[model samples]
Target: MVPCEDYLVSMIDLPDDSLHIIFHKLESCTDRNAFGLTCWRWLQIQNLARGSLQFKCSHRSSISDNVRYLSRLLGRFQQLNSISLAGCTELPDSALTQLRSSGSNLRTLFLDCCFGITDNGLSLVFAGCPALVSVSLYRCNVTDVGLEILAKSCPTLERVNLSYCTLLSDHGIGALSRECLKLRAMTISYCRGITGTGFRGCSPTLAYLEADSCLLTPDGLLGAVSGGGLQYLNVSSLRCWAGGDGLASIGAGFAKNLCFLNLRLCRFVGNESVGTIAKGCPVLEEWNLALCHEVRVSGWEAIGSNCHNLKVLHVNRCRNLCDHGLRALQDGCHQLAVLYMHGCRRVTWVGLESFRMRRWGVKVRGEENVSVGPSLDQFFL
Candidate 1:
């Protein structure tokens, strides 16, 4: 009685189908769930855009019953393109098997950090989602045989991330190199056993690669980066015995068209490598050379001078740098919005305070830099 008419007037009269379209645009699954429970029409959002599905069994709010209910609700819609079962430990094998056999047109899948999933459970996805373009299997205990089957079957795959997957090694990577040709990106980070030889002859169209901790040498890794038109690369924690020549190969092969490059902890690269990169990649924006022990001020100066459009740079923990390097960065890289100079003891507050006063937008976010100290030998070096 107290303004029921006023509330009704505020609500716009739209068709049920129109309301469904508005809710489907939201990327947040939580918001989607809330909207679905709002009204009967919103609950039927699957009829419009069942593009991305996330089966999160870890969250108590979206329990096992909720997943089952969702499967039933989505059973009618056969056009789902992406499915993310990040933490569904309680999800039965039968449920996944049934979903796959239903002829659902799923293409992208993310099974990040899901523990209950075994090889048997994963096999269902390969047989079902034959048109899959991207797959992320982080923290899963996938073995070589399972990987072979997936690589052989999923020929249309564009990207695959196997980060922190302990069981995977050169065996799986070699198998993939032989079979999968459509892959554009692959991440084998924390796979300690895989050497450089296993990554050869992969996709030529590969644009993104993240092999942070693999023992890939310059030549073996260069095969994947050189021939391909790569745009993003992260080869952190790599140890190359090829010396200056190896690091030079990185700049020679990969720098062109590369937007984001991370050579973190690749301890062998020196000033020569930096010079090559500056000459090769002019449009490079974001770079992380953190802990690359051999980098010097000359290298930093070359980067700053050449990569004028660079926005983000991280040289954290490189002891070779002095105030000269920081000054060069400030002088050349006018567009630099963020800088990480932690562990560079030679870099006094002179250069840092200058940028701090101007508020060079060097504010940190996402993660803190805790390694603030450098050895006594660092300043003298």
Candidate 2:
């Protein structure tokens, strides 16, 4: 393992004012105990800093009262900008409720995957967090009524990720979209209750949208105003947009300037849409074309020829990709950092009768050339 000194030496000599900025990036992100005990300087970094204080618990730890406890601990640094107590099964409502009035500077909050969280628990955040800008509630049980209250209360909300909150319907979306003109990013994945009507009314300035596993239709995907800026989109696993031409419409209308595109598991992405995306999105960077059963191997070649800036390519469970397509990506997309090609059964390097070479692929029972593909990370999930 690399030493902390080595890592510290790699970074530029940060000033006192900028140290807080750097500390904000590390204090909540880096290993907590290790970062706290690094040195007196490292320990003091967050003391004077005033940005965000995240108290997330991955395990089944009970920290309801602890949230307020930490606020008291950091009473002097009142410039706290955000707080996230995710997965704290025993987190008390009283402790969190008081933070609304106390942590006045907080702008963002993420309570993802907390099974124990209820409507009343979130109501505290909605009522308290007046200046909130972003919120993520993945796998949490925040219903439409609670979300409706949140939309009505928090006016500064811009980015929201409510993936897996299946109960939130058009009523919730309707209420929120009424005021959030500055909203940029949102994720309603697996929220089958919301459709095109819900989205069109809510987000006029939406740029980043991820609605995977939802019931959003083609009209819903096109709900954004023509002039409205919709850049990054990920709308995979929709049963409504399953036709070949429907996928093409998405390429022609919505995906023109999409920088990040993840259309994995979309039942209708074939050569037509693939070809259109390669031609449309010149500045495309990250792309996930995994589980697209209908997409032909030639589509990747077109993408390689067009999107030169392509970095991450995921082709998981695409059983149709052959050596021809794989070689095209290998030779064309030089900037690809990760390539996921797991479950692509047709992609093999077996000597097809006459073809012979010393650098044959690794001996795998099922996949003839599994070893010949990209790294394992590039190959699968």
Candidate 3:
């Protein structure tokens, strides 16, 4: 048998191709770092094998030092195809210019909360990264010109998130919708400037959208759902002139593929809107109606009769929801697994106990430790 030293030497003598295969199998950074530290050859191979880099700088670090360090890392990791500088608030436009060297290989870029990156920086970086497929710029200082540049430069983009990018308007969104033909998922939440008119030219490949707190209109809402392929949508707190009419139109037009919806804090949603959703969205599995006090007995009855596949429901603070509405749900939604009824003052203890007796498996939440005495007429059914 050979000595232990000889065996170690033989293991290290493996070909570079064989070592590259082993290096990629290492899922932990610690293990990969240890492998790289084994020798100079191993370190060079590890750098070449590295495809993704995530650099986060602490607030205590000097901005110049952070930029210098990141520039060195970009120079060293020449094969990197994905880069995430999320929450690196101090990074300026000059730091992104370092990307010019490796931009051709990059496919994913995330610069969330990097306030210093403006339209100029975006124009500088995107002109080089032609193969980019996914980009997220949450809370960035980018405006319509920057977005227009991105749309025109990267035709292969498939997923983008511009949430809280306050400077973005309908013009930017319109450019993105018209240019990015392969885009599938987009999040524009809290973009108050967008009135949803840009979505009229949205790509048919787009299926998932989250535009909560946007200033939407009936025509805009109609254009978004008319595609008949949307599966996930969240328009909570949508600011519209007549929200009830917009919601009713959504139920009437795009009821085919919807699976998840969040309508929380929509003050104008009334019985007609809820009833229409119940009848239209038959495959609906989850619905949030919290703080919607306008829904009465008729709306609850409609939900119970239709939404058979419903598994989760939130009706918190529904003042008009009493024993009648509770009974309708308990009798109909057999697939119900979770229910939230925290502030239903009109629902008495008797009704709650009766519903619990019928559906003991369901998780009833937000109604703990409350006294509902028989003498109290306020809580009486």
* TM-score, ranked from best to worst: 3, 1, 2
Cα lDDT tens digits, model 3, 217-298, are 8777776776676666778878755645448866895756776777877877888988888888888887888777788898
Judge candidate 3 at residue 52 and give its lDDT. 92
Q: What is the C-alpha lDDT of each candidate?
A: 0.70, 0.66, 0.83
| lDDT for residue 4 in candidate 1, whole number 0-100 | 72
lDDT of candidate 2 over 2-86, digit per residue (tens): 7777766433366656755655566444455355466677666655564666665524434644665655754645667776767
Q: TM-score for model 2?
A: 0.66
Residue-by-residue lDDT tens digits, candidate 1, 247-321: 676578554877777877777778998888877887778888787778888898898788877877888878887
* TM-score of candidate 3 relative to the true fold: 0.88
Which order, best to worst by lDDT? 3, 1, 2
Q: Give each model a TM-score.
A: 0.72, 0.66, 0.88
Off by over 4 Å in 1: 1-49, 58-79, 90-95, 102-104, 174-180, 239-245, 350-381
